[model samples]
Target chain A: MLFKGIAASHGIAIGPAFLLKVEELRHARRTLIDSSESEEEILRFRDAIISVKHDLENIADSMGDVVEGRQILEFLLLLLQDPTIKKEVENKIRCDKVNAEYAVSSTLLDVMDKFNIMKDPYIRERVADVKDVGRRIIEKLTGTEKDALNNLKQPVVLVARDLDPSETAGLKPGQVLAFVTDMGGKTSHTTILARALGIPAVVGLQKITVEIHPQDLIIVDGIHGCVIVNPTEKELSYYAEIREQFQEAESLLQQANPGPALTEDGVRYELAANIELPHEVEMVKSLAADGIGLFRTEFLRLIQEKGENEEDHFDIYNKMALDMLPKPVIIRTYDMGGDKFRTGLNSAREANPFLGYRAVRIGLDRPEEFSIQLRAILRASIHGNIKLMFPMVTHVEQLRSLLDLIKLVKNDLRVKAIPFDENMQVGIMVETPATVIALDLMLPYVDFVSIGTNDLTQYTLAVDRGNPKVAYLYDSFHPAVLRQIDTVVRLCHAQQKWVGVCGSMAANPLAVPLLIGFGVDELSVAPSLIPDVKKMIAVVTTHAAREMAEKSLSIETGLRVRALVHSYVIGKYPEILLDENDWKTGG
Target chain B: MIEKKITVPNKLGIHARPAALIVRAAVEFDCDVWVESPADKVNAKSIMGVMTLAASGGTLITVSAQGDQEETAVETVVEVIRSGFGEEMI
Candidate 1:
């Protein structure tokens, strides 16, 4: 059997599936007599609740000062003590004469259903908390729970519906070979934890937990976002050979540590990782990414609260800065609003949200909101290398105001006796054609510019990449977008302002050459793509890349440019680019 | 019952940490405390209830409690929001 999923972490793990079964509380209404049995069942339920409380208390106590762990336990404790739930359960037991477990489960399900109807993801996710505590109570009442994964006899490919943070905390690389989940995105807790732990993982398999039996032989190809189960001898040997070679290549890449990724002409280039979370600093450091090219600060808002406070942002930023000490971390301020407000924050439902107020627009309009982020980044810069970048910047004047706001924030920080890097380099994303046209006027405002080609392509071609009809037209390789990037890079270089690219184009195997040829000082790719991109850069010379760039620019369509550049790359290194199609499918 | 309407000032607006802190505070008083948004009301002492509120920054919520310490309960919660849950969020 074979299954495909979202590639989360990179590597291969061949091991037996260790199913982490979620003990879902099945609510089969148990009939209770209105006399002695009812009273006894209620007593039993009380005992179970007491036991659950004790369990949570123990867990909480064990965690000590671990904030998230303690918070979860505290929530569970509150749930157990919630008067409404207790009243609902008692009412069901008394009025309907149902068993204690049934009453508890049914009442919990009612709340879960209520939460389910909510359109807000934050509210919807609360259903999981209800379910978790419900399951705990049910487990106590029924006494039919599986042992925790910590009891596993050997290292195995952990398969689950979704590994919660607690479950993920228990999994060590020595105990768990890999993680495969039925549901999760690349940034899910399981995936993030796996990446930080250097464990290969594949998520969003949909039903891997249902199909996979305990101890079944499985091959988790994290690089491909697929898993093969109970493979035939031929398939097994083929994969086994690939796995061995992969290990060899991994160590070779690690050993090759060719610092700075210089071309044959000794032109040094910085390769950084585009990180969404601070936890990914581990992967970034291990992969030898020169720094974090793009830190999606929007995730900081999503994971915590909508427009999370400066303290939370500061703590995360400070830790990341210290963790990657001396390695530059370019934090992009909330590139949210428009179609991608995950928290259902309607920044006004405009028909054309893509062109609507977001990013630097939000910053310019809400300086009060933007100042907090600016202050946090500024304060965090004292720890280590931290560069701040604004996103969706289209106008030079707006860029000027945003920079001026940062200056005010710095003055405010000083007045308050807060120490920060007085000269933290601020930059703006060159993704809009307006910025491209105003390149000469824009270069002097900041230290550096990172061309976010993903948006630049969308805005340049006037096509939504998500729209299937015109999605094909959304190409970073398009002559105009490339020329825009080309213009920005040239003008930035001419002005002595270093330019990096943190977009899909940075990691695209074909676009890599053109980006290099265009004299992009830095390439900030997805952390997983770092090694492969490094390998591609190792053999190719600046002269060859420049020639590829010049030729591809002369080409008309993105398709032709892609074909030309990829052919040049393929011709340069035939062995490495193999199975490029079979790699992870999406973001 | 003592009741007062206060704005959620913290940027995250009653997320996990705030919810936990609120729950902790709500339980400290001898009151049947409840928090009401425009649409619905939930027990202030319940973490799940507070989280389910899904109150983002600048949303208004009314705190009501009925007990001997109802006055204190409402005031303490109001203070927590005012204090930005012990952080300089405001």
Candidate 2:
């Protein structure tokens, strides 16, 4: 059986399935204890708490600097030490004459209920922590404590409904071949960890947990987001060869220089990284990126319950600017809405969210909130090279109003005697078709423009990329999308403004040549893709790439454009393609 | 008894970490400390009590204390809550 899902992390893994089921704690029901036995019941609960704490401390000691894991353990430890929980449970054991396990479970359930009713989603999520603590205590009391994740005897393909960050953190390297979860998206925590660890992952399978059985043979194709169950002998050999080739390609890419990103014919372009968080700055440095092409600010909003304040934004941008000194860090303002976060003020479901209020629309609608970010970016500008970029600008008026707002913010900073870079370059992302057609008008107000191909493709083709039914229509290589990018790049160049592509297109092996051929000043991709992109750049000549791009634009469809680039690249750099068969089918 | 009014400071409010910090801070003084929100009041020295207050980022709350070091306890507990629990703040 073959199942498809979102290709979260890239690779292939073949192993026996290890189905992770969330087991409910089984503890004795409420039994009236003898009045004389109340003391013993209380003592039992205390002993169980102590044992759970000790076990958690052991896990914490072994977990070195995994932030999410440490937080979980710390929370659990604190909950155990909570005077109210212990007092409440002991009171129940004594006054209600209930058994120790029953008292503990009941008390913890009350706490979980309180958390569940909390208006704040972040607080509500804490019910998981309470449940975890309760399970550990109940298990300790019943002598049923089982460390399922740690007892893995061999490598297996881990399948689950969905993995919490704590569970993913408990994963021992090389013990799990891949992660196939029934829930999660491209930016889910599991996906992020899988990428960081270079493990194959396929998420949002919806029914994989129900379909998969323990010890069943499974093949996880992270590259194509496919899972093959109980594969035939011929299929096994086929994947084995592909997996070997993938590993070979990865090692080869790793050996390549991080880069000057110069084409064979002497065209130099900056190769940068698009990072979502501050920690990824380290990865960006290791890759020796020219700079950060896109520093997504949405993650901060998503993490912080009340949305990030100016100080939070300033601290991050300041540190990032200081760290990547001399290299530019283009921080894109929070691109919220549209499958991302909905503003606290207006979270009502939009019929067409992608086409509705989002990004710059939210910024303009809430100037007070938008200015907080603008203030932080301007303040951080003095620390290091930091550039501000706005997302989803569809018209000259939006650009004009945004520029006007910036001027007001700058004046406000001046009045307050705050030190900021007066000359900080401000730019906007050209992702809308309206912006692409009106590039000449918008160019005069901005310092530079970065073509965001992902949204551009979605908007240009009128396809919601996240909707499975229309996802097939979402392709950045489409001639219509390609023509808009070419036009934007040409307009930016004609006006002597810098231009770069920061979307997935920048990292795609097939799209790299066409972008380079379009004379993109920079290519900012995920840090892991930098080496691979640089290798591709070294093998392609500007003269030939330009010819390919020209031919690609004249092509009628995205498939042919892709085919044109694919054949051109394979002929020039055959090693870059995983294999002829995989490339031919557009894997 | 001494009482002081303050707002929850952290962006995430009194979640587990902040509640733990508040409880840790409250247990230091030789006095009874209690925090009262619009909905409920809880023992400042109890992590569960502090968390159950469910005081979101901007919710105003009152911290009151009695017994030895009453003034200092109220001030310290109120200060901790006001400090945004050392979380990311302006």
Candidate 3:
């Protein structure tokens, strides 16, 4: 039987289902302890308090390498030791003469009740942490080890109803093959943990835990969100072969060039890596990227000291530029919002964060933080390898203001006697339709343009990528999206400014040809995809790509466009298409 | 009594980190600190009360204090709110 769910972490795992049986919390009745026993009750509560405190501090102190564990644990520890909350719980035990477990659980319920009704997702999500602490404290007092995922006999597909934040911390690397959860969506802590663990996962199957039986044979296809349960031996062998072919092909890709991207036909394209965090630069270097394509420079603003100044920004940018060394690093001025982050004169809260004050919009409206960023980038550009870019360019005014801020920062640096590259190349992302149509108005201000196809497709199709129901409509290969790419590339070339395509479309083997045909000068892909994209560019001639791109415009539907591109790539290399059926249907 | 009304500006509002910071600062003052949102009033030092207020970004909330350090407590707490926990600036 096949079940569908959200494909979270990407991989394949075949294992016996190890159902994470979560035994319900079994606590004693809320009977009043005798007056003589009351002192013991308080003592028990005190001992548990110390135990829970030690537990949280241990987690915080030894945060080892959880990307965002220390700060969160610190916050949880503060919540655990709040004097006001301590007073409330103490009052319940002393005045009511109730058992410690009873008092603690009841007090947490009061907080949980309020959180359940909160409109803010961030506040509401904390309800889990509050309950985690409450449960931990109660377990210590009661000496109960209910539902602990402690030991496993062997590696198995760990399935659960709803994974708590605390439970996931105990997941040993090789003991659990993959994660399959019935609750929580794609961005839940469970999914994040799964991705971090580098395991196959499918979440929000709704009744996966109920349907999956222990020791049952299951194949988790993380790429397609398909879970095959108790498959026949024939079907099992088919998947095994596919997995082998995939790994073999991947190893072959690893042997591709570790140099600049030059097509076999001799056309040069900048194959850069998309880096969201600084740590990812190591992988970019390993993949041998020509440069950093879309450095999400906004993330540097987060998890930072409150009063970090221009020097702080300079430190990070300088390190990145030096690391890449002579390679152009296009640092986007924080395209924040829509699950990224909100900083710099813009609050995260908005009726419509996707469409509202975010990215360059906030920068133009209030230039305080924007000015600082410009100065930092300008100073770093003195290395002569850094290229600055702006996101969310829907208006000519936004681009003008952004350039104006760069002007102001340049003047400030000169006054401070700081030398920088006076002619640093500045660029804007042609993501929104307005920017694409108004290319003539905006190109004069920019030295290069990159297409952020992810957002462009979303806005053009009027589909929210977060809304799974309509997410299928948010295809980057939609004919209209292709037209937008074609227009941006064509317009940029006309003005003698370079254009690059970034995002998933740039890396997709099928979409790579279209982007090249659209006259994109660069393909900024994930570090892992850089080698594969470079190899594809090296093989495909730009002339044929342009011909295929022209024919794709006349295509009516997004499905046909995807098929067209798939067939074009597969016609040359049949192994590129896994199914081998996509090429046949394209005709 | 010292009182001031301020807007919560950080995007995530008074989530976890900001709530903890506010509580930490509140306990340092030798005064009774209270946060009054449009829906409910809560003790500023209590993480639950502060979080339960569910003040999203841009929500106007009032802070009041009464005691020896009332003037400083209210002033400090109000700044934290209006500042969006320093996320609005560098």
Candidate 4:
């Protein structure tokens, strides 16, 4: 049998299955003839709570001083001791004559229901924490809980309905051959942990746990997002070869050149990183990135209370600048609105939020709010090299007003006698067809431009990538999108301004050559992909890339264009396309 | 009994961390502590009760306590919430 899932991590694993089953606590309710039985039930509930508390304490102690681990454990421990939950659970046991497990589960249901209806999205998310605490108590009551993964006698393809953080925390590298889950997406904790451990994983399988027996032979093909249970001998031999090639690729990538990416013909291209949090600067530095090409400021919403204050922005930006000194840090001002941050007026009612009031529009309308960020960025400019950019600018008028706002912010700093970089570079994101056509007018006022290809594709094709019905139409490699990119590059080069592609397209191994061929000065990608992208850049020559881009430009369809690029890349670097994970099978 | 009205200073309002901080302080005194949002009131010693209060940033709440050291209990609990749970105030 074959099961398809999301290719969360890249690799393959073939081993007997190890199902991490979540024990269900099914208890029968019994009526108490005397008050003694009620007292006994209440005591049993207290004992379970105490045991769970010890379990949590042991876990927390093992975690040491990691702030997030400590905070999570602290929340769980507090929930375990919450007086309201304790009182309600005891009341149910005594009044309704239900077993300890039922009373605890039912009472938690009421608390979670109350939290589910909360107006604040953050509070609503905490319902998971409530559920987690309840599960621990029930497990203790039923005495059917243990870390099954910890007792693995041999490496196997671990299968589960879902692996929560607590279950995955004890996982060490090489402990399991692979992780296959019935739930999760690319950004889920399971995906993140699997990638971090360099383990092969396939998530969103829906029902792989039920299909496979306890010791069934399973082949987890994470690269293609599929799992084969009890493969034929012929299929096993074929995968064995592919697995060897993938291992060779993994080793090659490990030994890849850590220096700056330069073409064989000696042309250098800046390979930078796009980071969301301030602490991620460390990872960017470790990857030997050219600089931070895109520092998304949207994560600041988590602390929106302090986000409005100028000092809060200055402190974070100032530290980032100081740490990456000499290397340019391009901080994109708050890209709020849309699905994220619907806190403003009437955004919730918009039919087309992606095209509606968002990004620079919100920034321009609320100058008082906008200037606070501008003033902070300008003030932090002197601490280190800091470049400012605005997102979602469609016409020249928006560019003009944004430039005007920056000038006003600069003058405010001047009057206050605050030190700032007088020559800080300002750029704009060319994300829409209107911005691409008006690129000439906008380029003259800005120092540089970053093509946000993700938005450009959506806007260019008139399709929302999030909407599944027409998502197939949203392709960055379409002839129209490629032509637009060529025009933007040509326009920027004519004016001596450097252009960078800082979208998902920049990270694509196939798209790198075409972007370099277009004479794009920079390619800012995710921190993890910096090494792989840079390696690809090193193998391709400017002359060959130019030729490839020329041929790709005339290609009629995105699929054909992809095929052309694939052929060229497969010949140049077959290993780059192959998957990377452990070769657990001794070759 | 003693009571005092104070505004939640932290931008995130009384989230789990802030709720935990309030409960930790409330449990320190030998008194019955209670917090009252505009819509509801709950025992300050109960983490769930304080969290379910749903008081966001800039919300006005009343903290009250009775029994031994009632004034100290109300004042201490009120101070913790007003302190923004050590997070930066807006």
Would you list the clashing residue pairs of candidate 3?
A347-B11, A348-B11
Task: Find the candidate with the highest DockQ and give its number.
Answer: 4
* lDDT digits (tens) for residues A85-179 of candidate 3: 78777788778877677677778788787788888788888888888888788768645322334556678887877555435544556878788
Q: Which DockQ values do the candidates obtain, in the order shown?
A: 0.26, 0.43, 0.41, 0.44
Give one digit per residue, the lDDT tens place, for model 4 in A406-456: 999888889999999999999999889999998998898999999998778
lDDT of 1 at B54: 77
Clashing pairs in 1: none
Docking class of 2: acceptable
> Quick one: ranking by DockQ, best first?
4, 2, 3, 1
Q: Where is model 1 more than 4 Å wrong at Cα?
A: A4-10, A14-218, A223-225, A229-241, A277-289, A302-312, A315-327, A337-341, A344-358, A361-366, A382-384, A458-475, A582-587, B1-90
The B-chain TM-score of model 3 reads 0.91
Q: Where's the lowest-lDDT run of ten residues in candidate 4 chain A?
A: A578-587
Q: Write the per-residue lDDT of candidate 1 for residues A1-587, one digit (tens) a residue.
A: 88998677778889988766433664545567466777887777888889999999998999988987887777778888887788788888888898777798889988888788866676677678889999888877755213446677878898878765534543445788889987765444566556646668998887677677667899999878889999889878988888888888777866676466766567677899887656678878877789999987766665564445889989999999998988899999987765445234443576787877677777677789778888899999996599999888777788878878888988888899999887788888888899889888888888999998877887898877544344445667778988898898889988999999987677666777778889999998777667777877776788888898888778877767766766766776777644343222113
Worst 10 residues of 1 chain B by lDDT: B81-90
Indicate the worst ten consecutive residues by lDDT in candidate 3 chain A.
A578-587
Q: Which stretches of candidate 4 lie over 4 Å from their true place?
A: A1-3, A8-222, A226-254, A304-307, A339-349, A578-587, B1-90
Better of 2 and 4 by DockQ: 4
lDDT of 4 at A239: 84
Ranking of candidates on lDDT, top first = 2, 4, 1, 3
Better of 2 and 4 by TM-score: 2
